[model samples]
Target: MRTALRPHHLRWTGERDLAHAIYGTVVGTAAMATAGAHRTLGGTVATVLVTVAVYWVAERYADALAAAVRGPDRRARIGRALRQGWPTIEAACAPPVVLVAFVLVTGDLRAGVVVALAVSTVMLSALGHAAAKHAGATRLVAVGCATGSAVLGVVVILLKTFLH
Candidate 1:
């Protein structure tokens, strides 16, 4: 299977969106934890998972709403919603899983959070690079795309820093 970081096919385009969601979740969750919210690692993981689930559900709901508005058939609209929103819902799982794994292994909650954030940023960077290469962009353009995507992660990090 192609991952966001090593994507090599058209079907892997969904990885790009996953990369963004993962990064956003990691950064946002980490920030909230550091703000004296997550007193325990388990609590942090649970909170993040809940947030991810909510996001996934929200995406599905929005898609269903759009499908209903665009078409008249109930079954067809439900199918359209599933097709349009499944990628994002699936991708959104990556971050919470990563966070949970780290939290479970590492005794230090802060360190676990940092590691999760790093992993998410790396995934985003890889997705950016793969997307550019898949588009047959020049080396400079590819590099730019990678850098730009990675920078978005940094923006999240900055938000964590200032907001926390």
Candidate 2:
């Protein structure tokens, strides 16, 4: 694996990770919009699960890229993978947690919870990306995730308002 993992290869992997994150964000938003249209607790749960799955996949990609860059030292590779993946995991969890809290607090199984979760995902993604950048990860990848998440959030809101 180390023999195949050159610096350029790592760079390309990072770029791909960014692209995947962007694509995942867009798809997740669309899924959430559809879920919001149903206005049911089950739909909300499904949307959250879908979004979380997308985020989990993106994080896995990021971890793989980090591992590729970290080389053959297993301990170092594991550490780098964790460092790269943790922020994304946290960011992804924030939105669902907020949604659940809001649902429990307000007892309203409506589109508002989905909207709030989408917005929270964007905000948390931005903060997570910033932290990842500060920790020496690829800035472009972080920015891409953050920007994509924000755009998706806006699109979700628009779809919920106009289409749903």
Candidate 3:
């Protein structure tokens, strides 16, 4: 098999979208983790997806508006804003799949939720490390960034634990 194309290999965009990706992952994971147990798995998944989509749209809209104030082409600016933020949606795609797969195999929605949160936490750490390294941080700084991100994720999980 061919080697997987790393984000660093991208031409037009490297880790520029990492911020949005991290945000999306956090949003998705938090949504799944905190969704009440009364919700069916499908309902929880739908809620997570809709929540992410809404957040993405709201953020992009604000970006577009900011760009419009600085530029002349409103339509093109909006298009660019949406395109730039697409990584947010892409990043959120994995957690729902994890939730579904775990629920299917374990026959437990809560298990699926915790597993999905863990996966998102891992993604956040990796993204943080990549962002720091891309920014030319030292190795220790990169590791610190990753740890900080993971801690934030853990806090979200803990909130879910207390709430549920």
Best by TM-score: 3
Enumerate residue pairs that collide in model 1.
Answer: none
Tens digit of lDDT per residue, candidate 2, span 1-24? 673355321332343344444444
Q: Could you tell me which 10 consecutive residues in candidate 3 have the lowest summed lDDT?
A: 3-12
Prediction 1 global C-alpha lDDT = 0.61
TM-score of each: 0.71, 0.50, 0.88
Q: Which stretches of model 1 miss by more than 4 angstroms?
A: 1-11, 14-36, 72-74
Ranking by lDDT: 3, 1, 2
The C-alpha RMSD of each candidate to the native structure, in angstroms, is 4.3, 9.8, 3.3
Put the candidates in TM-score order, highest first: 3, 1, 2
**Native-to-model Cα distance after best TM-score fit, residue 111 in candidate 2, in Å:** 4.4
- Candidate 3: which stretches are off by over 4 Å? 1-15
Clashing residue pairs, candidate 2?
none
lDDT of 1 at 148: 84
- Between prediction 2 and prediction 3, which has the larger TM-score? 3
C-alpha lDDT values of all predictions = 0.61, 0.57, 0.81
Tens-place lDDT digits, model 1, residues 1-164: 44534632344565445454444444444443444355676776666666656666776787777777764587788776765534444444555567668767866666666666666567667667877876888999988988887776677666656655
lDDT for model 3: 0.81
